[model samples]
Structures are given as structure tokens and as C-alpha cells.
Target: MCSNLQKAMIDLIEVFHSYSGKEGDKYKLSKEELKTLLQNELSGLMAESKDPAVVDKIMTDLDENQDGEVDFQEFVVLVAAVVVACHTFFEDLDKGNVTPCSRS
Candidate 1:
């Protein structure tokens, strides 16, 4: 049986592959694919940002080779960055440095 972390890793691979290979490339994500993946899989994360250009910004930042597509390596960097950001948010919340809810 795989550990939880192993399962998570597998799921990430599965999720990436599910969205990828649907268009022109079998191993990379085109801009549209990335946008779909973000909107469908990471809706909450995407919803946090108000800027309409957020997806464009993310695509540019993640397409490290300037190939107009995001490969697995580039995708991993994005996952890591997002995970780090989430961890930092939780850490801050745990330390009471950030407000969890501001009741009106």
C-alpha cells in the first residue's frame, strides 16, 4: 500500500496527465490546458486572485523555457511554489499572525 504522500504524488501525476495530452502536445500543457486545469482543479486558489491576468502571469512564469507550454518540470515548480505559499499561510495562521476571519 502506498503512503499518503505517495498517493498524493500519484494523484498529482494523474491529474496533470488528465489535463495534458488533450491538445497538441502529449506531455506539455498549452495555455488553454493550464487555464482549464487551474479553473477546474484549483478553483479556490484561482478565485483568490482578482486580476484577470493572473492566468497569463502564471503561464508566463511557469513556462520556463519560453516554449509556450508547460512541461512536467515546469509544472512541478508551480506546484512547489503553491505548496510553499499554502504552508506559509498556514504557518502564519497558526502563529496568529494572520486573521482567519474578520467578523463584520
Candidate 2:
């Protein structure tokens, strides 16, 4: 049986592949693919951003190789960062530094 962590890793790879290879470079995510992935899979994150150029900014930051596309390594960096951010948010919430109802 796959452990929960293993399953999560598989899901991450699967999700990346599902959104990649549609336009160019079967192993990398094009800007459009990244945009679609963000809109569909990370809608909450996307919605939380007020900047209209958020996608562009993310692309610039994530394309570490200046390749104009996000490969699995770069993609993993983004996922890790988000996971850490969520962990921090929850830690803050637990410490009463963040109110859960602040959004509502």
C-alpha cells in the first residue's frame, strides 16, 4: 500500500503532467498551462492574489533557468513554498496570531 506521503508525491507529479505538455516541451509547463493549472487546481491561491499580473510574476520567479517554462524541479519549489506558507499560516492561527474568520 502506498503511504500517504508517497501518494501525495504521485499526485503532485500526476497533476503537473496533466497540465503540462499541452503546448510545448512535454516535460515542462508552458505559461498557459501554468495559468490553467493555477486557475483550476489552486483557485483559492489565485483568487487571493489581487495583482492582475500575478501569473506573470509567478512565472518569472519560478522559471529559475530563464527557460520561460517551469520544469518539475521548479514546479516542486513552488509546491514546497506553498506548503510551507500553509504550515506557517496554521502555526500562526494556532498561536492566535491569525483569525480564521478574517476572510469572512
Candidate 3:
């Protein structure tokens, strides 16, 4: 059985791959491809202020080896960061600290 973290990482990778019509294939996303995917697929999930720069920053931070691309492991770390940020945002909302609104 995989650990929780391992499972979450796999799930994130599957999501990334599924969007590319290449699920369960041996593939690693180049920087530009990953940026496009994140912008198109994750924009709704992220803040309205999210743009290419935001994605680039994320890629830079997560691409630990400075490879200018993200492997599955790097993508997993990126997903985890987003998950944590979202959780914190929701927790703040639940505390009556902030109101949530749709960007559109």
C-alpha cells in the first residue's frame, strides 16, 4: 500500500497526464507545457490574480534541480503547495475571516 503522500502525488500526476490525453504513459512535462496546462486547467481552482508569472514562479520553486521542466515528483510538490494554500484559505473563510467570491 502506498503512503498517503505517495498516493496524493500519484493522483496529482495522473491529473496532469490525463489533461494531456496521455494517461498512464511515461512522460514528463516541459516547462512551457506544464505552464499551459496549469493555466488552462487550474485557473478556476486558483486565484483570479493567477497568471503566467504565477505559474512560472511555481515552476521555478518546485523544479528543484533547475531543469526548466517538471517531472512527476516536481509536479507532486507543486500540487501539495496548492493544496496547502487552498486549505489555509478555506480555513480562514470558515473562521469568518474572509468572504469567498467567484472571480468570474
As for lDDT, the candidate ahead, 2 or 3, is 2
lDDT of 1 by residue, 4-99 (tens): 999999999998999998888989999999999999988988888999999899999999899999998899999999999989988998898987
> What ranking of all candidate models by lDDT puts the best one first?
2, 1, 3
**Winning candidate number (TM-score):** 2
In terms of lDDT, which candidate is strongest?
2
User: Lowest-lDDT window of 10 residues in candidate 2?
Assistant: 95-104
What is candidate 3's lDDT per residue for 2-102, written digit by digit as tens?
99989976776677776543333346667667767776778676457636487677778877988666777777787777789989999998998978885
Can you tell me which runs of candidate 3 are displaced by over 4 Å?
1-11, 19-26, 45-47, 50-52
Candidate 1 Cα RMSD (Å): 2.2
Candidate 2: TM-score?
Answer: 0.95
- Report the error of model 1 at residue 81, Å: 0.5
TM agreement with the true structure for every prediction: 0.92, 0.95, 0.70
- Tens-place lDDT per residue, model 2, 19-94, is 9999999999999999999999999889889999999999999999999999999999999999999999999999
Question: Which window of ten consecutive residues has the lowest lDDT sum in model 1?
Answer: 95-104
- Local lDDT at 51 for model 1: 100
Model 1, stretches more than 4 Å misplaced?
Answer: 101-104
**Candidate closer to the true structure by lDDT (higher is better), 1 or 3:** 1
